[model samples]
Target: MAENYVLRTQRLLSKLPFSSWLFGKVISRRAPYFGTITPRITQVIPGKCECLIRKRRGVENHIGTVHVIAIANGLEMAMGTMAEASIPRHLRWIPKGMTLDYTAKAGSDIRCVAEVDQSAWQVGDMPVTVTALDDNDTVVVKGSINLWISEKPSK
Candidate 1:
Protein backbone atom coordinates (compact mmCIF):
# COMPACT_ATOMS: atom_id res chain seq x y z
CA MET A 1 0.00 0.00 0.00
CA ALA A 2 1.15 3.52 -0.67
CA GLU A 3 2.03 5.69 2.30
CA ASN A 4 -0.35 8.50 3.18
CA TYR A 5 1.09 11.80 2.03
CA VAL A 6 0.14 13.67 5.23
CA LEU A 7 1.67 11.00 7.45
CA ARG A 8 4.80 10.69 5.34
CA THR A 9 5.33 14.43 5.25
CA GLN A 10 4.81 14.75 8.99
CA ARG A 11 7.43 12.06 9.65
CA LEU A 12 9.94 13.56 7.24
CA LEU A 13 9.57 17.12 8.49
CA SER A 14 9.68 16.08 12.13
CA LYS A 15 13.32 15.12 11.64
CA LEU A 16 14.35 18.51 10.28
CA PRO A 17 14.93 21.88 11.91
CA PHE A 18 11.99 24.28 12.10
CA SER A 19 9.61 21.39 11.42
CA SER A 20 6.50 23.27 12.55
CA TRP A 21 7.18 26.05 10.09
CA LEU A 22 7.68 23.54 7.30
CA PHE A 23 4.47 21.77 8.15
CA GLY A 24 2.51 25.03 8.13
CA LYS A 25 4.02 25.95 4.81
CA VAL A 26 3.05 22.62 3.32
CA ILE A 27 -0.51 22.97 4.58
CA SER A 28 -0.80 26.52 3.27
CA ARG A 29 0.30 25.39 -0.17
CA ARG A 30 -2.38 22.76 -0.24
CA ALA A 31 -5.18 24.86 1.25
CA PRO A 32 -4.68 28.57 1.02
CA TYR A 33 -7.69 29.45 3.15
CA PHE A 34 -6.36 27.34 5.99
CA GLY A 35 -3.31 29.59 6.10
CA THR A 36 -5.46 32.36 7.51
CA ILE A 37 -6.07 30.36 10.69
CA THR A 38 -2.39 29.45 11.17
CA PRO A 39 -3.23 26.03 12.51
CA ARG A 40 -0.67 23.78 14.14
CA ILE A 41 -1.25 20.07 13.73
CA THR A 42 -0.38 18.57 17.11
CA GLN A 43 -1.44 14.99 16.54
CA VAL A 44 -2.69 12.75 13.75
CA ILE A 45 -3.45 9.04 13.66
CA PRO A 46 -5.78 6.62 11.96
CA GLY A 47 -9.00 8.10 13.28
CA LYS A 48 -8.14 11.32 15.04
CA CYS A 49 -6.35 14.66 14.63
CA GLU A 50 -5.77 17.57 16.96
CA CYS A 51 -4.89 21.12 15.93
CA LEU A 52 -4.27 24.39 17.70
CA ILE A 53 -4.78 28.01 16.67
CA ARG A 54 -3.48 30.92 18.63
CA LYS A 55 -5.77 33.82 19.38
CA ARG A 56 -4.46 36.76 17.42
CA ARG A 57 -5.65 40.12 16.20
CA GLY A 58 -6.14 38.81 12.71
CA VAL A 59 -8.58 36.19 13.90
CA GLU A 60 -10.48 38.31 16.37
CA ASN A 61 -13.97 39.62 15.87
CA HIS A 62 -15.29 43.08 16.71
CA ILE A 63 -15.93 42.00 20.30
CA GLY A 64 -12.32 40.81 20.78
CA THR A 65 -13.36 37.20 20.53
CA VAL A 66 -12.00 34.68 18.10
CA HIS A 67 -14.06 34.91 14.95
CA VAL A 68 -16.35 32.05 14.11
CA ILE A 69 -14.88 31.66 10.69
CA ALA A 70 -11.38 31.30 12.06
CA ILE A 71 -12.53 28.58 14.41
CA ALA A 72 -14.24 26.85 11.50
CA ASN A 73 -11.04 26.95 9.51
CA GLY A 74 -9.13 25.35 12.32
CA LEU A 75 -11.81 22.71 12.68
CA GLU A 76 -11.58 21.96 8.99
CA MET A 77 -7.82 21.57 9.22
CA ALA A 78 -8.18 19.07 12.02
CA MET A 79 -10.80 17.09 10.12
CA GLY A 80 -8.78 17.15 6.91
CA THR A 81 -5.71 15.87 8.66
CA MET A 82 -7.66 13.05 10.26
CA ALA A 83 -9.24 12.09 6.96
CA GLU A 84 -5.88 11.98 5.24
CA ALA A 85 -4.45 9.61 7.80
CA SER A 86 -7.55 7.46 8.23
CA ILE A 87 -8.64 6.84 4.66
CA PRO A 88 -7.13 3.83 2.97
CA ARG A 89 -4.65 4.49 0.20
CA HIS A 90 -7.08 3.10 -2.33
CA LEU A 91 -9.73 5.57 -1.17
CA ARG A 92 -10.00 9.30 -1.80
CA TRP A 93 -11.92 11.88 0.22
CA ILE A 94 -13.17 15.41 -0.27
CA PRO A 95 -15.03 17.66 2.14
CA LYS A 96 -18.59 18.01 0.90
CA GLY A 97 -19.93 20.44 3.49
CA MET A 98 -19.78 21.50 7.13
CA THR A 99 -22.23 22.47 9.83
CA LEU A 100 -20.99 24.37 12.86
CA ASP A 101 -22.48 25.71 16.07
CA TYR A 102 -20.86 28.28 18.26
CA THR A 103 -21.52 27.38 21.84
CA ALA A 104 -19.50 29.91 23.82
CA LYS A 105 -17.18 32.86 23.65
CA ALA A 106 -13.62 32.05 22.73
CA GLY A 107 -11.39 34.26 24.82
CA SER A 108 -8.15 32.35 24.37
CA ASP A 109 -6.22 30.10 22.08
CA ILE A 110 -8.31 27.28 20.65
CA ARG A 111 -7.70 23.57 20.25
CA CYS A 112 -9.75 21.57 17.81
CA VAL A 113 -10.15 17.82 17.84
CA ALA A 114 -11.64 15.74 15.02
CA GLU A 115 -12.47 12.07 15.12
CA VAL A 116 -14.02 9.37 12.96
CA ASP A 117 -15.21 5.84 13.58
CA GLN A 118 -13.44 2.97 11.87
CA SER A 119 -16.76 1.43 11.07
CA ALA A 120 -17.72 4.58 9.24
CA TRP A 121 -14.95 3.97 6.71
CA GLN A 122 -16.61 3.21 3.42
CA VAL A 123 -17.32 4.58 -0.04
CA GLY A 124 -19.99 7.08 0.81
CA ASP A 125 -20.68 10.26 2.67
CA MET A 126 -18.97 10.20 6.05
CA PRO A 127 -19.84 12.64 8.80
CA VAL A 128 -17.00 13.47 11.16
CA THR A 129 -17.41 15.36 14.41
CA VAL A 130 -15.07 18.12 15.50
CA THR A 131 -14.98 20.14 18.68
CA ALA A 132 -13.10 23.30 19.48
CA LEU A 133 -12.13 24.00 23.07
CA ASP A 134 -10.94 27.17 24.73
CA ASP A 135 -7.98 27.48 27.08
CA ASN A 136 -10.21 26.45 29.94
CA ASP A 137 -11.18 23.27 28.11
CA THR A 138 -14.67 24.59 27.52
CA VAL A 139 -16.33 23.72 24.26
CA VAL A 140 -16.62 26.84 22.16
CA VAL A 141 -17.54 25.31 18.86
CA LYS A 142 -18.99 22.02 17.69
CA GLY A 143 -19.23 20.95 14.08
CA SER A 144 -19.79 18.13 11.68
CA ILE A 145 -17.78 17.77 8.50
CA ASN A 146 -19.35 15.74 5.73
CA LEU A 147 -16.86 14.15 3.40
CA TRP A 148 -17.43 12.35 0.17
CA ILE A 149 -15.33 9.20 -0.11
CA SER A 150 -14.69 7.08 -3.18
CA GLU A 151 -12.17 4.77 -4.74
CA LYS A 152 -8.98 6.30 -6.00
CA PRO A 153 -8.52 6.52 -9.73
CA SER A 154 -6.31 3.83 -11.26
CA LYS A 155 -2.91 5.02 -12.38
Candidate 2:
Protein backbone atom coordinates (compact mmCIF):
# COMPACT_ATOMS: atom_id res chain seq x y z
CA MET A 1 0.00 0.00 0.00
CA ALA A 2 0.97 3.62 -0.48
CA GLU A 3 2.62 5.18 2.53
CA ASN A 4 0.87 8.47 3.06
CA TYR A 5 1.31 9.29 6.72
CA VAL A 6 -1.02 12.26 6.56
CA LEU A 7 -3.90 10.06 5.44
CA ARG A 8 -2.98 7.40 7.95
CA THR A 9 -2.93 9.86 10.81
CA GLN A 10 -6.21 11.36 9.72
CA ARG A 11 -7.82 7.93 9.63
CA LEU A 12 -6.52 6.98 13.05
CA LEU A 13 -7.08 10.27 14.83
CA SER A 14 -10.49 10.90 13.32
CA LYS A 15 -11.93 8.04 15.36
CA LEU A 16 -11.27 9.80 18.65
CA PRO A 17 -13.42 12.44 20.31
CA PHE A 18 -12.74 16.05 19.40
CA SER A 19 -10.49 14.65 16.73
CA SER A 20 -10.94 17.53 14.31
CA TRP A 21 -9.80 20.09 16.86
CA LEU A 22 -6.91 17.90 17.90
CA PHE A 23 -5.88 17.36 14.30
CA GLY A 24 -5.92 21.10 13.69
CA LYS A 25 -3.56 21.67 16.60
CA VAL A 26 -1.24 18.98 15.32
CA ILE A 27 -1.16 20.48 11.84
CA SER A 28 -0.65 23.99 13.18
CA ARG A 29 2.21 22.82 15.32
CA ARG A 30 3.85 21.37 12.22
CA ALA A 31 3.17 24.52 10.19
CA PRO A 32 2.83 27.38 12.63
CA TYR A 33 1.53 29.85 10.04
CA PHE A 34 -1.75 27.97 9.80
CA GLY A 35 -2.42 28.82 13.45
CA THR A 36 -3.24 32.39 12.53
CA ILE A 37 -6.87 31.58 11.73
CA THR A 38 -7.11 28.57 14.03
CA PRO A 39 -8.66 26.38 11.36
CA ARG A 40 -10.49 23.24 12.42
CA ILE A 41 -9.94 20.24 10.12
CA THR A 42 -13.41 18.79 9.99
CA GLN A 43 -12.79 16.08 7.40
CA VAL A 44 -9.95 14.43 5.43
CA ILE A 45 -10.58 11.79 2.81
CA PRO A 46 -8.99 10.90 -0.48
CA GLY A 47 -9.33 13.89 -2.83
CA LYS A 48 -11.41 15.95 -0.41
CA CYS A 49 -10.95 18.00 2.76
CA GLU A 50 -13.29 20.16 4.81
CA CYS A 51 -12.29 22.87 7.28
CA LEU A 52 -13.93 25.52 9.43
CA ILE A 53 -12.95 28.88 10.86
CA ARG A 54 -15.02 30.83 13.34
CA LYS A 55 -15.77 34.53 13.01
CA ARG A 56 -13.53 35.50 15.88
CA ARG A 57 -12.07 38.87 16.73
CA GLY A 58 -8.61 37.94 15.60
CA VAL A 59 -9.89 37.03 12.13
CA GLU A 60 -12.15 40.04 11.69
CA ASN A 61 -11.43 43.02 9.50
CA HIS A 62 -12.14 46.79 9.74
CA ILE A 63 -15.72 46.38 8.56
CA GLY A 64 -16.48 43.58 11.06
CA THR A 65 -16.20 41.06 8.25
CA VAL A 66 -13.87 38.13 7.96
CA HIS A 67 -10.58 39.12 6.43
CA VAL A 68 -9.81 37.79 2.98
CA ILE A 69 -6.34 36.74 3.99
CA ALA A 70 -7.65 34.87 7.00
CA ILE A 71 -10.09 32.96 4.83
CA ALA A 72 -7.33 32.36 2.29
CA ASN A 73 -5.16 30.91 4.99
CA GLY A 74 -7.95 28.57 5.99
CA LEU A 75 -8.49 27.57 2.37
CA GLU A 76 -4.80 26.89 1.92
CA MET A 77 -4.79 24.72 4.97
CA ALA A 78 -7.60 22.60 3.54
CA MET A 79 -5.91 22.27 0.12
CA GLY A 80 -2.47 21.48 1.48
CA THR A 81 -3.72 18.89 3.92
CA MET A 82 -5.92 17.29 1.31
CA ALA A 83 -3.03 17.05 -1.11
CA GLU A 84 -0.85 15.42 1.49
CA ALA A 85 -3.48 12.80 2.17
CA SER A 86 -4.41 12.06 -1.43
CA ILE A 87 -1.05 12.07 -3.15
CA PRO A 88 -0.16 8.95 -5.06
CA ARG A 89 2.51 6.53 -3.82
CA HIS A 90 5.14 7.16 -6.48
CA LEU A 91 4.25 10.85 -6.86
CA ARG A 92 4.48 14.01 -4.73
CA TRP A 93 2.75 17.37 -4.79
CA ILE A 94 3.36 20.95 -3.70
CA PRO A 95 1.16 24.03 -3.98
CA LYS A 96 2.67 26.41 -6.52
CA GLY A 97 0.04 29.16 -6.22
CA MET A 98 -3.54 29.96 -5.32
CA THR A 99 -6.19 32.16 -7.00
CA LEU A 100 -9.17 33.35 -4.99
CA ASP A 101 -12.32 35.31 -5.87
CA TYR A 102 -14.24 37.22 -3.20
CA THR A 103 -17.78 36.85 -4.40
CA ALA A 104 -19.73 37.66 -1.25
CA LYS A 105 -19.28 39.28 2.15
CA ALA A 106 -18.07 36.96 4.81
CA GLY A 107 -20.35 37.91 7.68
CA SER A 108 -20.24 34.66 9.62
CA ASP A 109 -18.17 31.57 10.25
CA ILE A 110 -16.64 30.00 7.14
CA ARG A 111 -16.57 26.43 5.96
CA CYS A 112 -13.77 25.74 3.50
CA VAL A 113 -13.82 22.74 1.22
CA ALA A 114 -11.24 21.51 -1.29
CA GLU A 115 -11.76 18.78 -3.84
CA VAL A 116 -9.41 17.08 -6.32
CA ASP A 117 -11.14 13.95 -7.50
CA GLN A 118 -9.47 13.36 -10.84
CA SER A 119 -6.33 11.26 -11.24
CA ALA A 120 -4.00 14.04 -12.25
CA TRP A 121 -0.81 12.86 -10.65
CA GLN A 122 1.26 13.08 -13.81
CA VAL A 123 4.32 15.28 -13.86
CA GLY A 124 2.62 18.59 -14.39
CA ASP A 125 0.39 21.19 -12.82
CA MET A 126 -2.93 20.10 -11.33
CA PRO A 127 -5.58 22.51 -10.19
CA VAL A 128 -7.68 21.86 -7.11
CA THR A 129 -11.01 23.59 -6.61
CA VAL A 130 -11.67 25.23 -3.26
CA THR A 131 -14.66 27.11 -1.93
CA ALA A 132 -15.40 28.99 1.26
CA LEU A 133 -19.02 28.95 2.37
CA ASP A 134 -20.66 31.21 4.89
CA ASP A 135 -22.95 30.09 7.71
CA ASN A 136 -25.87 30.36 5.31
CA ASP A 137 -24.10 27.99 2.89
CA THR A 138 -23.30 30.81 0.50
CA VAL A 139 -19.99 30.87 -1.30
CA VAL A 140 -18.15 33.85 0.10
CA VAL A 141 -14.91 32.96 -1.64
CA LYS A 142 -14.04 30.61 -4.48
CA GLY A 143 -10.73 29.65 -6.03
CA SER A 144 -8.34 27.07 -7.37
CA ILE A 145 -4.95 26.08 -6.07
CA ASN A 146 -2.34 24.99 -8.59
CA LEU A 147 -0.15 22.13 -7.45
CA TRP A 148 3.10 21.05 -9.01
CA ILE A 149 3.18 17.27 -9.15
CA SER A 150 6.42 15.38 -9.49
CA GLU A 151 7.99 12.03 -8.76
CA LYS A 152 9.42 11.31 -5.34
CA PRO A 153 13.16 10.81 -5.29
CA SER A 154 14.42 7.30 -4.81
CA LYS A 155 15.51 6.41 -1.28
Candidate 3:
Protein backbone atom coordinates (compact mmCIF):
# COMPACT_ATOMS: atom_id res chain seq x y z
CA MET A 1 0.00 0.00 0.00
CA ALA A 2 2.77 2.40 0.98
CA GLU A 3 4.59 1.42 -2.17
CA ASN A 4 1.57 2.38 -4.24
CA TYR A 5 1.48 5.80 -2.64
CA VAL A 6 5.14 6.32 -3.37
CA LEU A 7 4.57 5.28 -6.95
CA ARG A 8 1.63 7.62 -7.29
CA THR A 9 3.68 10.46 -5.84
CA GLN A 10 6.44 9.72 -8.29
CA ARG A 11 3.94 9.66 -11.12
CA LEU A 12 2.55 13.02 -10.03
CA LEU A 13 6.03 14.45 -9.84
CA SER A 14 6.78 13.25 -13.33
CA LYS A 15 3.62 14.73 -14.76
CA LEU A 16 3.20 17.99 -12.85
CA PRO A 17 6.66 19.52 -12.69
CA PHE A 18 6.19 19.97 -8.95
CA SER A 19 8.71 21.67 -6.73
CA SER A 20 10.00 20.25 -3.47
CA TRP A 21 7.10 21.82 -1.61
CA LEU A 22 4.58 19.90 -3.66
CA PHE A 23 6.62 16.74 -3.34
CA GLY A 24 6.76 17.09 0.42
CA LYS A 25 3.02 17.54 0.74
CA VAL A 26 2.36 14.21 -0.95
CA ILE A 27 5.16 12.44 0.89
CA SER A 28 4.19 13.70 4.33
CA ARG A 29 0.42 13.31 4.01
CA ARG A 30 -0.87 10.71 6.50
CA ALA A 31 -2.98 8.28 4.50
CA PRO A 32 -2.40 4.90 6.12
CA TYR A 33 -4.31 5.38 9.31
CA PHE A 34 -7.47 5.97 7.32
CA GLY A 35 -7.55 2.28 6.27
CA THR A 36 -7.28 0.99 2.71
CA ILE A 37 -7.54 4.43 1.20
CA THR A 38 -6.42 6.05 -1.97
CA PRO A 39 -6.31 9.74 -2.84
CA ARG A 40 -6.21 10.51 -6.49
CA ILE A 41 -5.56 14.09 -7.53
CA THR A 42 -7.54 14.21 -10.73
CA GLN A 43 -7.18 17.81 -11.79
CA VAL A 44 -4.80 20.70 -11.21
CA ILE A 45 -5.38 23.31 -13.83
CA PRO A 46 -4.45 26.83 -12.80
CA GLY A 47 -6.61 27.77 -9.82
CA LYS A 48 -8.41 24.50 -9.32
CA CYS A 49 -7.71 21.14 -7.72
CA GLU A 50 -9.98 18.11 -7.60
CA CYS A 51 -9.42 14.97 -5.58
CA LEU A 52 -11.37 11.87 -4.62
CA ILE A 53 -11.33 9.55 -1.62
CA ARG A 54 -12.96 6.16 -1.31
CA LYS A 55 -14.75 5.66 1.96
CA ARG A 56 -13.55 2.77 4.08
CA ARG A 57 -14.41 1.52 7.53
CA GLY A 58 -11.79 3.70 9.12
CA VAL A 59 -13.54 6.76 7.76
CA GLU A 60 -16.92 5.66 8.98
CA ASN A 61 -18.52 6.89 12.12
CA HIS A 62 -20.43 4.78 14.66
CA ILE A 63 -23.54 5.16 12.55
CA GLY A 64 -21.89 3.35 9.65
CA THR A 65 -21.71 6.58 7.70
CA VAL A 66 -18.74 8.61 6.68
CA HIS A 67 -17.49 10.63 9.62
CA VAL A 68 -18.01 14.38 9.43
CA ILE A 69 -14.54 15.26 10.63
CA ALA A 70 -12.91 12.87 8.24
CA ILE A 71 -14.66 14.46 5.30
CA ALA A 72 -13.81 17.92 6.60
CA ASN A 73 -10.16 16.99 6.88
CA GLY A 74 -10.24 15.70 3.33
CA LEU A 75 -11.69 19.00 2.18
CA GLU A 76 -8.88 20.84 3.91
CA MET A 77 -6.40 18.51 2.30
CA ALA A 78 -7.75 19.28 -1.16
CA MET A 79 -7.54 23.02 -0.57
CA GLY A 80 -4.10 22.99 1.03
CA THR A 81 -2.79 20.62 -1.57
CA MET A 82 -4.04 22.96 -4.27
CA ALA A 83 -2.44 25.93 -2.58
CA GLU A 84 0.88 24.14 -2.34
CA ALA A 85 0.75 23.37 -6.02
CA SER A 86 -0.57 26.76 -7.17
CA ILE A 87 1.71 28.94 -5.10
CA PRO A 88 5.11 29.61 -6.56
CA ARG A 89 8.26 28.11 -5.15
CA HIS A 90 9.57 31.45 -3.83
CA LEU A 91 6.65 31.72 -1.43
CA ARG A 92 5.61 29.75 1.63
CA TRP A 93 2.10 29.13 2.85
CA ILE A 94 0.49 27.88 6.05
CA PRO A 95 -3.08 27.34 7.14
CA LYS A 96 -3.76 30.32 9.40
CA GLY A 97 -7.40 29.53 10.05
CA MET A 98 -10.41 27.53 8.86
CA THR A 99 -14.16 27.24 9.21
CA LEU A 100 -16.36 24.25 8.41
CA ASP A 101 -20.03 23.73 7.70
CA TYR A 102 -21.50 20.28 8.20
CA THR A 103 -24.51 20.62 6.01
CA ALA A 104 -25.45 17.03 5.31
CA LYS A 105 -24.89 13.46 6.37
CA ALA A 106 -22.32 11.58 4.37
CA GLY A 107 -23.56 8.07 3.77
CA SER A 108 -20.95 6.81 1.35
CA ASP A 109 -17.55 7.48 -0.12
CA ILE A 110 -16.55 11.09 -0.86
CA ARG A 111 -14.93 13.43 -3.31
CA CYS A 112 -13.34 16.79 -2.50
CA VAL A 113 -12.79 19.62 -4.91
CA ALA A 114 -11.17 22.98 -4.07
CA GLU A 115 -10.61 25.96 -6.29
CA VAL A 116 -9.33 29.55 -6.20
CA ASP A 117 -9.42 31.94 -9.16
CA GLN A 118 -6.48 34.14 -8.29
CA SER A 119 -4.32 34.89 -11.29
CA ALA A 120 -1.12 35.79 -9.48
CA TRP A 121 -0.04 34.90 -5.97
CA GLN A 122 1.83 37.51 -3.96
CA VAL A 123 3.22 37.27 -0.50
CA GLY A 124 0.51 37.92 2.04
CA ASP A 125 -2.71 36.28 3.26
CA MET A 126 -5.64 34.68 1.53
CA PRO A 127 -8.62 32.38 2.09
CA VAL A 128 -9.74 29.38 0.05
CA THR A 129 -12.73 27.11 0.45
CA VAL A 130 -12.64 23.38 -0.07
CA THR A 131 -15.75 21.29 -0.34
CA ALA A 132 -16.50 17.61 0.15
CA LEU A 133 -19.44 15.76 -1.30
CA ASP A 134 -21.00 12.37 -0.73
CA ASP A 135 -21.73 9.77 -3.36
CA ASN A 136 -25.14 11.28 -3.91
CA ASP A 137 -23.51 14.66 -4.59
CA THR A 138 -24.65 16.42 -1.46
CA VAL A 139 -22.20 18.57 0.39
CA VAL A 140 -21.03 16.84 3.51
CA VAL A 141 -18.61 19.51 4.67
CA LYS A 142 -17.17 22.73 3.44
CA GLY A 143 -13.93 24.13 4.86
CA SER A 144 -12.55 27.59 4.37
CA ILE A 145 -8.85 27.65 5.15
CA ASN A 146 -6.96 30.84 5.82
CA LEU A 147 -3.54 30.75 4.26
CA TRP A 148 -0.54 32.87 5.21
CA ILE A 149 2.06 33.30 2.52
CA SER A 150 5.59 34.55 3.11
CA GLU A 151 8.59 35.12 0.93
CA LYS A 152 11.05 32.29 0.51
CA PRO A 153 14.82 32.44 0.02
CA SER A 154 15.96 33.64 -3.38
CA LYS A 155 17.38 30.87 -5.47
Candidate 4:
Protein backbone atom coordinates (compact mmCIF):
# COMPACT_ATOMS: atom_id res chain seq x y z
CA MET A 1 0.00 0.00 0.00
CA ALA A 2 1.13 3.50 -0.75
CA GLU A 3 1.97 5.55 2.31
CA ASN A 4 0.00 8.69 3.03
CA TYR A 5 2.76 11.25 3.00
CA VAL A 6 0.76 13.86 4.86
CA LEU A 7 -0.14 11.47 7.68
CA ARG A 8 3.33 10.02 7.83
CA THR A 9 4.96 13.42 8.04
CA GLN A 10 2.51 14.61 10.65
CA ARG A 11 3.16 11.54 12.78
CA LEU A 12 6.94 11.87 12.48
CA LEU A 13 6.95 15.57 13.21
CA SER A 14 4.63 15.23 16.18
CA LYS A 15 7.51 13.63 18.05
CA LEU A 16 9.92 16.50 17.39
CA PRO A 17 10.38 19.52 19.63
CA PHE A 18 9.99 22.02 16.80
CA SER A 19 7.37 20.18 14.82
CA SER A 20 5.56 23.24 13.55
CA TRP A 21 8.70 24.81 12.19
CA LEU A 22 9.78 21.62 10.51
CA PHE A 23 6.31 21.06 9.07
CA GLY A 24 6.37 24.57 7.62
CA LYS A 25 9.69 23.83 5.98
CA VAL A 26 8.38 20.57 4.55
CA ILE A 27 5.33 22.33 3.14
CA SER A 28 7.35 25.20 1.79
CA ARG A 29 9.47 22.75 -0.14
CA ARG A 30 6.45 20.92 -1.49
CA ALA A 31 4.30 23.92 -2.32
CA PRO A 32 6.19 27.14 -2.71
CA TYR A 33 3.10 29.38 -2.86
CA PHE A 34 2.02 28.17 0.57
CA GLY A 35 5.40 29.35 1.81
CA THR A 36 4.43 32.95 1.02
CA ILE A 37 1.87 32.80 3.83
CA THR A 38 4.15 30.80 6.12
CA PRO A 39 1.47 28.30 7.12
CA ARG A 40 2.01 25.84 9.96
CA ILE A 41 -0.11 22.77 10.07
CA THR A 42 -1.45 22.33 13.58
CA GLN A 43 -3.62 19.28 13.09
CA VAL A 44 -4.19 16.71 10.39
CA ILE A 45 -6.46 13.69 10.25
CA PRO A 46 -8.65 11.96 7.79
CA GLY A 47 -11.31 14.45 6.64
CA LYS A 48 -10.05 17.40 8.70
CA CYS A 49 -7.07 19.73 8.78
CA GLU A 50 -6.14 22.92 10.60
CA CYS A 51 -3.36 25.40 9.92
CA LEU A 52 -2.16 28.70 11.32
CA ILE A 53 -0.56 31.70 9.65
CA ARG A 54 0.80 34.71 11.49
CA LYS A 55 0.00 38.15 10.21
CA ARG A 56 3.30 39.43 8.92
CA ARG A 57 4.42 42.34 6.77
CA GLY A 58 4.75 40.02 3.81
CA VAL A 59 1.05 39.18 4.00
CA GLU A 60 -0.18 42.69 4.77
CA ASN A 61 -2.38 44.59 2.41
CA HIS A 62 -2.38 48.26 1.40
CA ILE A 63 -4.47 49.13 4.44
CA GLY A 64 -2.19 47.22 6.79
CA THR A 65 -4.60 44.31 7.16
CA VAL A 66 -3.99 40.72 6.14
CA HIS A 67 -4.31 40.36 2.40
CA VAL A 68 -7.29 38.37 1.15
CA ILE A 69 -5.08 36.29 -1.06
CA ALA A 70 -2.93 35.32 1.88
CA ILE A 71 -5.93 34.01 3.76
CA ALA A 72 -7.00 32.12 0.68
CA ASN A 73 -3.59 30.56 0.42
CA GLY A 74 -3.80 29.39 4.02
CA LEU A 75 -7.22 27.93 3.40
CA GLU A 76 -5.95 26.11 0.34
CA MET A 77 -3.14 24.61 2.37
CA ALA A 78 -5.57 23.31 4.95
CA MET A 79 -7.75 21.78 2.27
CA GLY A 80 -4.82 20.16 0.55
CA THR A 81 -3.65 18.56 3.76
CA MET A 82 -7.09 17.20 4.52
CA ALA A 83 -7.41 15.76 1.04
CA GLU A 84 -4.00 14.21 1.13
CA ALA A 85 -4.67 12.47 4.42
CA SER A 86 -8.23 11.41 3.71
CA ILE A 87 -8.17 10.15 0.14
CA PRO A 88 -7.65 6.42 -0.31
CA ARG A 89 -4.35 5.39 -1.89
CA HIS A 90 -6.05 4.05 -4.99
CA LEU A 91 -7.63 7.43 -5.69
CA ARG A 92 -6.16 10.73 -6.83
CA TRP A 93 -7.39 14.26 -6.44
CA ILE A 94 -6.83 17.80 -7.69
CA PRO A 95 -8.33 21.11 -6.76
CA LYS A 96 -10.80 22.12 -9.42
CA GLY A 97 -11.61 25.61 -8.13
CA MET A 98 -12.40 27.68 -5.05
CA THR A 99 -15.04 30.14 -3.84
CA LEU A 100 -14.35 32.53 -0.99
CA ASP A 101 -16.12 35.21 1.04
CA TYR A 102 -14.31 37.74 3.18
CA THR A 103 -16.52 38.61 6.11
CA ALA A 104 -14.18 40.87 8.08
CA LYS A 105 -10.71 42.35 8.25
CA ALA A 106 -8.16 39.88 9.49
CA GLY A 107 -6.31 42.09 11.94
CA SER A 108 -4.49 39.29 13.71
CA ASP A 109 -3.03 35.85 13.14
CA ILE A 110 -5.43 33.50 11.43
CA ARG A 111 -6.29 29.81 11.71
CA CYS A 112 -7.80 27.96 8.81
CA VAL A 113 -9.85 24.78 9.23
CA ALA A 114 -10.92 22.55 6.40
CA GLU A 115 -13.21 19.52 6.50
CA VAL A 116 -14.92 17.01 4.26
CA ASP A 117 -17.45 14.22 4.58
CA GLN A 118 -17.21 10.54 3.70
CA SER A 119 -19.65 11.20 0.88
CA ALA A 120 -17.09 13.47 -0.71
CA TRP A 121 -14.71 10.60 -1.33
CA GLN A 122 -16.44 9.35 -4.42
CA VAL A 123 -15.15 9.79 -7.93
CA GLY A 124 -16.49 13.17 -9.03
CA ASP A 125 -16.57 16.77 -7.92
CA MET A 126 -16.43 17.35 -4.18
CA PRO A 127 -16.79 20.60 -2.29
CA VAL A 128 -14.77 20.98 0.89
CA THR A 129 -15.53 23.81 3.31
CA VAL A 130 -12.70 25.84 4.78
CA THR A 131 -13.11 28.64 7.32
CA ALA A 132 -10.55 31.11 8.57
CA LEU A 133 -10.78 32.55 12.07
CA ASP A 134 -8.84 35.38 13.63
CA ASP A 135 -7.06 35.34 16.97
CA ASN A 136 -10.28 36.40 18.64
CA ASP A 137 -11.97 33.30 17.22
CA THR A 138 -14.17 35.31 14.89
CA VAL A 139 -14.67 33.99 11.44
CA VAL A 140 -12.94 36.27 8.97
CA VAL A 141 -13.19 34.22 5.81
CA LYS A 142 -15.28 31.30 4.59
CA GLY A 143 -14.89 29.27 1.43
CA SER A 144 -15.32 26.00 -0.37
CA ILE A 145 -12.74 24.31 -2.53
CA ASN A 146 -13.94 22.04 -5.31
CA LEU A 147 -11.74 19.02 -5.91
CA TRP A 148 -11.84 16.54 -8.73
CA ILE A 149 -11.45 12.97 -7.49
CA SER A 150 -10.78 9.97 -9.69
CA GLU A 151 -9.37 6.46 -9.46
CA LYS A 152 -5.65 6.28 -9.98
CA PRO A 153 -4.54 4.68 -13.21
CA SER A 154 -3.34 1.08 -12.98
CA LYS A 155 0.36 0.98 -12.33
Best by TM-score: 4
Off by over 4 Å in 4: 1-3
After the best TM-score superposition of candidate 1, give how far the Cα of residue 6 lies from its true spot, in angstroms: 0.8
Model 4 agreement with the true structure over 64-105: per-residue lDDT tens digits: 888999999999999988888899877899999999999999
Candidate 2 pairs with clashing backbones: none
lDDT of 2 by residue, 128-149 (tens): 9999999999999999999999
Per-residue lDDT over 50-143 for candidate 3, one digit per residue giving the tens place of the 0 to 100 score: 6666677877889888887777666666675677557765677888888888888888778888888665477777778688888888888886
Residue pairs with backbone atoms closer than 3 Å in model 4 (clashes): none
Better of 3 and 4 by TM-score: 4
| TM-score to native of every candidate shown | 0.92, 0.94, 0.73, 0.95
| lDDT by residue for model 1 (64-139), tens | 9999999998999889888888888778899999999999999999999999986788999999999999999999
lDDT of model 3 at position 49: 68
Weakest 10 consecutive residues of candidate 3 by summed lDDT = 1-10
Tell me the deviation in Å of residue 98 in model 2: 1.2
Could you tell me which 10 consecutive residues in candidate 4 have the lowest summed lDDT? 1-10
How does candidate 3 fare on TM-score? 0.73
Candidate models: Cα lDDT each: 0.89, 0.90, 0.67, 0.90
Candidate 4 displacement at residue 20 in angstroms? 1.6
